[model samples]
Structures are given as structure tokens and as C-alpha cells.
Target: MITKEKILERVGGEEYLIRHLVPTFSSKVRKKNYKSIFSEKDDKPSMSIYKERGVWKFKSFNTGHQGDVFRMWADYYGLDCRTQFKELLELIDQEMCLGLNAERKSIVTPKSIFPNSPTVKDPAASFPSQTLRIEYMSDYESFISRLYLKYWLQYGIDQSVLEKFDVKQVSFLSYTANSGRCLSFKYFEKHQVVSAYHISGRVKVYIPEIAFSFSSDPYFKGQKKSFSYKNQNKDDVFGLVQLPEGNLDYILFTAGEKDCMSAYAHGFSNVISLQSEHQMPSEDLLRVLRSKTSVLLCCYDNDEAGKNASKKLRDSFGIVSVQLPEDVKDIAEYFQRYTPNDFQLLLGYGVQQVQSITVNPIDTHRVRRLSNTKRSKVKSYLSNKFNFRLNVVTQEREMSTKRNPGLWEKINVNELRDNLDRHGFECNLDLINCILKSFFVERFNPIEAYFLTFEGNEFDDGKDYIRRLAHYVHLKDPTPFNTRYWYIHLKKWMIRAIRTVFEPEGINKHALILCSPKENIGKSYFCEFLCPLSLIRYYNSNPVISNEKDAQKSLIRNFIINLDELHQLRSNAHVIKTWLSQRYVNIRLPYQEDEITASRIASFLGSTNDVEFLRSDLGHSRWISFEVESIEYIDDEAKYILEKSWEQAYHLYKLNPGSGELSKEELLELSQRSDQFTTKSTEAELMVQYLTPSTKELGEFMTATDILRYLQEIVGITIRLNTKLVGTSLREAGFDRVMHSDIKRYGYFVQKGLI
Candidate 1:
């Protein structure tokens, strides 16, 4: 039952077992005064048992041959320590079965290679008819030695020169194409050749489908370039990274495309997906990554062959494995939920200008009844309000590959539903559609219609995206329960603004919001509390809203900004706010003109840097940052206290639909208390207080940056202001003048670079 991997690790390999074990045991047993081991006519072992110590058994496919059933003939041929191994393989079926599972087949197999039992993920299939297992340990080498030495003496070793061979010979695999499913090998040492045919002795040979590593090195230094296929056909299939002299950086591999597909789907898109049936070596995959930016494998997942292929592929990218999620079953699914929109958020641009936008939240009666003149006005309003230029790019695509087979197969919705009910999860259809939709909705998440096909590798993203969704939901409601449990807790709170806009009631939108305490608390927690998608989408779309004003809306309609961890981000001495802010806002790669979106945005921040939000981008107005210092929450634990905290946003949204909720005093307090912007000295504070305009005007608000920088300019200077000046409604022609203490000293800080 030893696995192909474990077999190679022992007894040399499949090749060695074929050429040596059978013969080596024969010469020794016969010389020990044992009867001839085989019948002359059939050439199959015919040894008999004496019901004593060291026994031998012959199990082979030749006797009434059956599939994978290594036949057992000799039951208990007793010999002394002279014939231990032959007896051990006969008695070791229980242990071997631990590593691999074979039925009452012709051969005894170690149990590790097959299912621990006949049942798959289904438990009902586990029973005596389908072998069940309860233990898991494989001391392979020790077991090998114990079995071999038990029968080694009977093999008649030449003691003086046998010490090296005395150690259990590890198994090595060899490929043979001439015999279907048969294994064979001949040994030629530095001086002599040893062939075994009639010498197969009392033990029987159990052949397996051969496997090989593509290699051509003189000493098997790398993967071989040639392969053995059906019909004994020879093919040139593997190639290494060849230099000018034809030397390779490493060996290349030959494996089914399915293996490479799983690797790519799991995020290692750098391995070649070959058409060969022979397994690819781990080292070759590592080489492929070094040779290219991306690689993919596409293969069918019919059995263990597929699972093993992916395991080896992942192992090739060992460290990067940590970068992948544990639950993804295959590739297409991984990308399904992590569209490009989420990337920008991770790359540090989820702030004011990186937030999600709304374009005409609802279709109004006016919009529906507009005349041509009014239509022109409406288009103009859209251009000014949303900052988007509309256009359509369309072209009929010509097929470059074979025509899709499914195209010829007619289908209807009911048929699709039936097929999906049985096989859709395997293909990840719903999730793929979601990803496709997200892509079209955001420029940052441009969609690609792949040569769609159903394969196991398509669902890798399901596990990871689901986990993220669950985490978001958990933040809103810590209780571990079903979906309905969450809806109950959040329904009332979500109803305030987002409820009627998401489903039967309304449409829903995606938005990024940041929250923070005065300077050192709660932003990360706040991000968690937002319930990013799942929970928010559920209740908001129920039969909630009852208004004609809500009809003709976008697929998305309302959003909230949550930023409780802002304070925590500010206090970290080394790249603290930088890391957190990077994930929530900014354009990291100025070289590219495309907008950043979603999780991909998170990774683009690289390590750390300042993330500046452009006030010019239409993204600015969609988000609303809340200051923890400007507000307070009543502690509650219906599910989690954070849910109660997030409720404040709904209240604000109801009070003012999009951008007009927080009052003037709230904003002023937030600006003054923000740890990221304040000057430490009282003089600096006074300078900041002196020139500030006392009006709530939009144009004046836009200058807040220059005003803060000016304060940064006058930090050490003495200044005074008529603080009462704030009461006046300042004129719309907004302007500010910088105040200074000693004009001479002011330039000194600038000269010394302290300012």
C-alpha cells in the first residue's frame, strides 16, 4: 500500500523492486536448503508453507489476474531469519494498508496512497465492505528495515560485501511503455549485469501504472526531455531554461494541464501546464516561475491524480503558499470575488477621492418625462455632477479557437437550472457571474470574458471571498449563526438610509468610509464594523422601501463610510498611518492612467508611503469621514458594540442624503484634533486661529489644505487673533493671509529645514 512517493523513498524504487528483490531472495533461500521456489512450467512461484517461523507468500496479477489485485499463493512458507522479508511482506498487509488501501486485490499495499477508506467526503459509504481506517502515522524507513531484515538472511547475502546492501534498499520508480500497467527494470553496476525473470522467487511482483520525472541530465540531474506514451510512442516534451551553450538553469517538467491550472488558480501562475500524463517534478515548477511572469494549468479533476498534481505544484512555490487561502478548491473561483475594484482599496486609496460614486441614484418622473431640451440639460447635469464621460465601445468578436461545443447544444433556463442544481457548484457559475458584473461596473475592475469551460480549478476564490464576507458579517454581529440571525440584528439600523435602496425595496451601492478617534483609536475596528457586503445587501433589498421616489434607481443606491481605526493608524511610530491609509486611499502607480479598485488597490501600496487623496477626482464627494472625537456612542452588546457604533452613519445619511450630515462644529473639532495635521506649539495654534475664515462655504472649505500648511509655516511665531471674528458670515471671495512673529526668524526654520 505504499504510495508511489513513499515507494521511491524505499527499496530504491519500482525499478529496483523489479530487478533486485525477486532474485536476491531466491539465491539465498534455495542455498539455505529450501525447496525450489517456483514451478518449472508456469514460471510462477510455487513455494509451500511449513507452518513455522519466517514465511513467504506470493501475490501477483498473473494468477486468475484481476485489476490491482496482487495474487497470494504461498500462505506461510516457514524459514528461519534466513528468509525474513518474504515472510514480512506476507504478514505486513495490516501496516501497509495503513499507508495505502487496496481491496482484496492480488497485492498487499501500504494504506497511505489511497483513501483511508472507501468513503469520500461522504460518511455513509464507510463500512466493512469499503475499508475504514482510524490511525495516521508512517515510520516508513523503520518499517522497511524491519520487513526487509526479517527475510534478508534467507536471501543468502555474501556477508563480507553485503553491509551496504544490508541497509533497506529504498525504492526507485522506472517507466516501461511496452507492457500496459507493468513495472520492470534491469541493473548494470560498474562491472556486472543482474537480470531477474525466473529468479522472481517466492515473492510475486505487483505492477503499477508507471510515473516519471521528465529529465535528460547525464546523471538524471534535471527533468528528462523525452517521454513514453501510449503505443510506446516517444516524444520530446520537456525543456529546461537553456543557455547559449545548451546548458539548463534547471530541469523542466511534464505534467497534465490540470496541475498547472490549479497552481495558477491558487495564485502561482508561473508553471507550465503540459499535455503529458507523467507527473511534473517540483524543481521544474520552481524553474518555470523564474522563467516567466505567469503560467497556468488546465486539467480535469477526475481523481487522486489531480489532487496530487496540485499538491506538488503548490509545494514548488512553498513560501508563496502562505499567500494563498487554504479553502479554495481551484483557480477561477479565486478571482471571482477579488475583482480589481478591491485592489485599489488595499493599495491605500479608499479615502475621500477613492470612494464609490452614485450617478442619478433614482430614475425620477422628471427624468422620464423630459423633453429634448430638458434631456440636454439632464446630460449636462450628469457631466457636472458625476465627472464621467459616457461612450460605448462595441465590436463583434470573431472566434479564434474551436467553436464552443456548448453553442451547438441548445439550452433553456429550466435546463440550466436543472443542470446547475446537479453540477453548477462544481463550475462556480454564480460566483463567476458576480465577478464579471463587478468588473463591468468599475473601470478599475475591467472584465474579461474567458474561454469559459467548467473545470475543478474554477472555484478557488469561493473559500477566501466567503471567509472575508463572514468576517465582515461577524464584525456587525459577533454571534455565530445563520444568515437570518444577522438580518434581524441589522434590519432596523440599516433601514434608516440603505434599506429601501437594495432589493425589492431599493438599490445598493459600494462606498468606503474612514473613522477615527482624536488621533489614536478605533479605525481598523470601524472598517470591520461596516459589514462590507453580505449583511448589508441582505436586508437593504427586502420589501422595505415604499416610495415612488425610489424607483428607476441604479443597481446601487446608498453607502456609508466607516473609519473607527483612524486613531490607531496615527499612533504607530513607524509607517503606522501610512500602512492603514494605503489600503483605504491613493494612486500608488502614477505611471498608469487607469483607476485603482478593490483589494488589488490594497496590494499596490507596496510597503509604505504617503497616500494623498486628490480633491479633484469625483471620488471625493461620495465618501464621508467621521471623527470619533466629534461623536460618542452608547455602549451596547445586542450582538457586538461595534454594530451600535456603525448605526450613527445611518442616522447621518437620513438627516442628509449624500454629503450634508455633520455640522460645522463637528468638522472644526475633527480638523483641530486630527493627529495627522496638528502643530504642537501654542504659537502655531494661534497662527492657525488668526487667519481662518469664519464661514461655512464650499470654496472656503477647499482651501483647508493651504491653511494647514500655512499653520505648519508659522509654528514658532507669536500671533494673535480676534477669536470673535468667527461669528461673521464671511464673503464668498475667499482668501487668507499668513501671520508671522519675527519675519526674519520665520525664514530661519525654513533655511534650517525644521519647518
Candidate 2:
């Protein structure tokens, strides 16, 4: 018996508490935040847990649940406070016995809640400890009754199967003097019986009304009731001993002992069963199965509960499931309904047949060595000798009178590379790189051609597309002369989005920035619409990207990386500019052993309220900025229209991708206008307003201090700056220094068209 204080001390405090409780609740601790592991869609941290005052405390933002560690653990196990305390005490006692050689300590008995009662030991303290014991029958012949054998035979379990598993029947007397019988299935471990499962065959005696009035009815006199022993080692599966002694090609798992016997009778020697439908195999048993068997077949009953259990097993262990015929439910019923030959045919039909490929390790290693210096030779060798080909399929197919949308399916290059590596291949990096590069090039050509087809059509015209999109989102064009100007900006964005999908390499060379100082302009929503939902990775909070390693993390697969709430990022424009211009990026996935160079496939999109977003020195080549002023609420109708339009554009692009080129004049105008609208800094803005054009005369030379004062007086803007800082700001704003010979002062001259 242990007290709460003693238990806490023995279990090594709150960290241990958290470690124990989190797994029990099917939660995971990632970067100190506890989150649900069951759902992939739930990316947010479910609870914030921390240790305080020598105890663990947690608050669940998802459920509005807050409590100390003990209460949380109790809630997870569906236990009341008192019962949970008792359980915790027992758990701590077990841990102390295992981890430390602590002497037996007296438990603190809590005072009774009842007013008159005294303190006493917890009720759980008196509970019997479960132990495994094997009981042998002294009268085996007498116990194996005719009724018991007949009962089993009715269920298609013959005497031979019963003898093979060493099952028995027993009669016993209960405390109530009622007589009963049960069929017992003995469980063996390493050829020794450690436990047994008993199926009761007891019937209640119904006395007549006159006999019930008597103190003892004649029918019930000297009757003995039956009792079954509970097995402590319940984790072990029931029929492992019956499994064949060599490598099994496939093992059929059933839901009960009878099912196991039925399967064995039907010529499935490689069969195992759980104690009941509700019990799953233990980890040790699963590991053994994995090592010995090539395939696992879940042959549970056809009922709802059994199907659910089978699915759970399939997901957890990656096993294939076998469903019975419509009329049959369990293995016993199936044996009753069909002949052995029919059962074999049904088993063959139920098995999932997967094609297997075998590779020679020496040949793979030789090919890998050849790939490093002679990539083309290796490619030719693999193509001719191994019949390797990059498989890419069309994105549409004719179905009846209408065309159905098709999916992009290609040979998995990573899996191929892994297979090569597993076969003792060296220089796998070079081999994989060459193969993937070829595959991408081969795959993307058709996609690029499909996008180009939309250029000439009226419905897919760049201007018409943008106009429809703007109207759907309720966006008003800023300039009256050409709503087409806004359309041109949007067209550039559409090209970028298309390129992100079709061009896997160098797609990160530019990023799109949607800027607005006001909220509810649908900036983020538009970003989501441009990319597929599966390929969009969101950063609700800014991630560290100041270094190469940090920058590498942002290139997650082929995703459109969304840097939402861009104002929170402490990174300056120069870092972002460098990141966006890279053709290839270094990636070190968390589980990988070495860093690998991957083609830059991720496209960055950021939304922010900051008007002057980038540094003055950073050029506009890598950024396409859009200033959205429309702040109207988008209703369901508008959302549907937007989705439909975007889908049309995507399908058109996939059908007819254009030649990957942009008009030089159009691109230059769009870049300049985009820079003016969103990318210019405060200092650049002021220079654009004040500086004279290059055709006009240059402004007068003045000291930095004097220029600052003039700007303050003219613009009604106050800025605190020293001469050095002012000079730096001016240089960044495209201003140059000129000498005033008479005054002997070197002051900055504001060149025309500097902005």
C-alpha cells in the first residue's frame, strides 16, 4: 500500500505522469505540445501541458478541458477520483518494485467521508491479485461426457481437432448447490499449459410454484453450480501451438477458439485466434507473426462488431481482411455450409494477391557504382536490360458521351530507389537523382502543353478569366482606363500557379504576395483556391527561416507554402529574396540520415497588411504583388462561382498547357506596377514622389540633415535620423552623392526616375 506522496516520489514526478497518461489517451507529444495522433487533419496542438509546483497541469484548447495530471489521467481511463487514486497507488507500487528496491511502506488511509465511520483501507486493497495456474483433470474419462462431445460436433468441430488442441469438459458444484458443466480450452506456452478458457453450459432449474414454497425443492437438492478460472496471462493468443513449425506463407486469424478449430478442420494449418472477438493479439504475438508469416489474413465474423474489430486490426498491423459469403457469418458456419473443396475456393477468392518483384543485390550494387560517373550509360542499361520506363498517363478519358477527369499517375521513383538501396546498391543518390529528373521531364511536357491551349480561347482568355474571378470575389478594379491592367497582374499570377503544378524544378524562383491593409478581402481564400488542398501547407505562425537549414524545411514536398499573417515574421526582405531565387534547395527530413539536394518545387504565397513590404535594395523579379482593396463579404453563391471558375481554369490548363514563356514587355510593365503598388519601401515611396525625372534637371545638392529638414517642412512628416542612417536610406532609394564645389560639401543628389 502506498500514499499519494510516496507514489509521486517513486514514479519520478510530473514528467512520468505525462508520459504515462498521453499514450493512454492516444495523444502524442510533439515539441512539448500534446496533440491527437488519431486524425491527420487535426494539425493544431490539442493541449498545452507543463509542470508547475511539482505537479503537471494541462489546458485543452480543443475541448475547453483543464485539470492537473492525475485528474486528466483518471478522465482518460473513465475512473472516478477515489477509484483513480487507488489505481494510481497500485501502479506506483508496481513501478517502485520494478525501478527501485524501496522497502515496503505504510499507506496513508484517508479519513472516511461518512460522519460516524472511521478510517479504513481502500476497497481495492482487498481485491484478489490475478495469477496464472494450470489445473489438470484427475478424472479425464469421466469429465469428457457424451453431451459435451455432441455439443462441439454440432458446431463442425470434430473429435480429432478437439484432441489436437487438448480441450476438456468438466462438472463442478457451485456455492448455491447448483450443478453445471463447461467445455474448457487449455492454453499452452512453450508446450506447457499456462491458462484455459471455459465455455459454460449451465442451465437454470425452474421449480414449480408448489416446490418453490418449500425450503428446498427436490429438483434443486444437492445440485452443484459451476465456476470458471480467470486467466491472468490474457495477452497470449489461444491457438499459437497449432501453427506449423516453419515459415508460413499466410496465417489466417480468427475471432474465437471454435473458429480456430473450424479453420484447422478445413485444412488451414496456419491459423491462430484471439480469446474472443473483442480481444486483439498482444504486441509480442504480432511481432512473432510478422517475423514468421508473409501475409496475415483477418478472418473474423461477418457481424458489425467483428467487421469493425477486423478493420482496426488491418489498420494497426497492415493485414488483409477476409469476409465470409453472404449467408455465412463465422468460420464454423462456413464449414457447415460448404465442402472442403468449396472452402478452399472461397479462401482463394478472399486472399488479396499482390505482385512481388525480386531483385539481385550484386546486380543492383554494380548498377549503382556505374551510375556515379556514367549516368547516361546506367540509364540506357536500366532501360534496355531491366525494361525500365517512366510511366505517365493522360488527365482525361472519354466515358460514354462525356469526358471524365483523370488523375496524374506515375511510377513511384522513391519506391524504386528504396528497392535499389535495400538490395545493397551504393551511390543510390546519383541513380535516384538521374531517374527522377528524367521522369519529371517526361511527365511535365504534356502538362505544359495543356496549359498553353487556353491562351487563344475566349472563355479561357487571360482578361476574361481575371474579370470573372474578380466579379466572383466582389473585387473592384482600381483603375477605370483598363480593368485589363488588374487582369494582366492576375494573369501573371495564374501563370505562376500553373508553373507550380507543371514545372517541378525552379518553381520557387518567384513568390506571389497579396497585400491589403484591410481585412475580409479574401486574400488567403484566393491563395487556397489557386493550389490543390492536399498540396497547400499552411504556417499559422511564422517558422524560423534565417538559415539554410530553416529555409529547407519550408520546401515541404510539392506544396504551395502559405506564410499567413506575414507581419509576424521577423525575417527581412533580403533573406526572403535569396530564398526565392534558389533553383535547388537542400532538404533534411526529420527521419532521414543525410541531407539530400531536391529540386525546388514549393511556391511561396504570403498575405499581409503591410503596404511597403520589401527592402529597397531587393529587386522586383522574384515577387508579384497584388493590392486588393475590396472588403466585401463573399456569400455562398460567390464562393461557388469562384470555385467553378478556378476549376475550369485548372482543367483547361491541364488539357492545353502553353509554351512556357511570358511576353517581355507585359512582364516588365506588370513587375514595375506590382513593385509600385506593394513592394516599395517608405523611403522609396518618398523618392518616387520628390525626385525629378531623368529628363528633368537634377535636384540641388544638400547635406543629409538639410534634406531631412526640407522633407519634414514640405511633406509634414517627422523622422528622427542621424547623417549616416539618412545617407544609407538615400543610397537605398537610388540617390547618388554630388559635390558642391563652392560650398566644399559632399551631399547626396536625388537622381531623376530613381524610384
Backbone collision count in every prediction?
A: 109, 18
Worst 10 residues of 2 by lDDT: 173-182
lDDT tens digits by residue: candidate 1, 1-755: 43335443433333333222232344233332222222123454433322123333333322231111122212211212233433334323221222122222242222211122221111111111111111111233444233323222222322211221111122322322111112333211111111110000000112212113322213322211111111101111222211112232222232432233323333332334233432343322333344442222223233455455544444333211112233443232333445433422322231222123222323233334442343233333322322221010111111111233222221132443354446422323453232222211111110111101111123332233222222333222233443333232233233333322211112122123333223333434434334433233211221112321221111122233232222223332223222222211111122222111111111100101112221111122222322223212213332343433234333433444443223456445433323332223442344334553433332233233433445545653344322222111111113343233434221111111123
Highest lDDT scorer: 2
- Model 1 stretches astray by more than 4 angstroms: 1-276, 279-562, 568-755
CA RMSD for every model? 29.8, 30.5
lDDT of each: 0.27, 0.51
Candidate 2 residue-pair clash tally? 18
lDDT value, residue 186 of candidate 1: 23
Q: TM-score for all predictions?
A: 0.18, 0.34
Candidate 2 all-Cα RMSD:
30.5
What would the per-residue lDDT of candidate 2 be over residues 63-86, giving only the tens digit for each residue? 655678666654443345565576
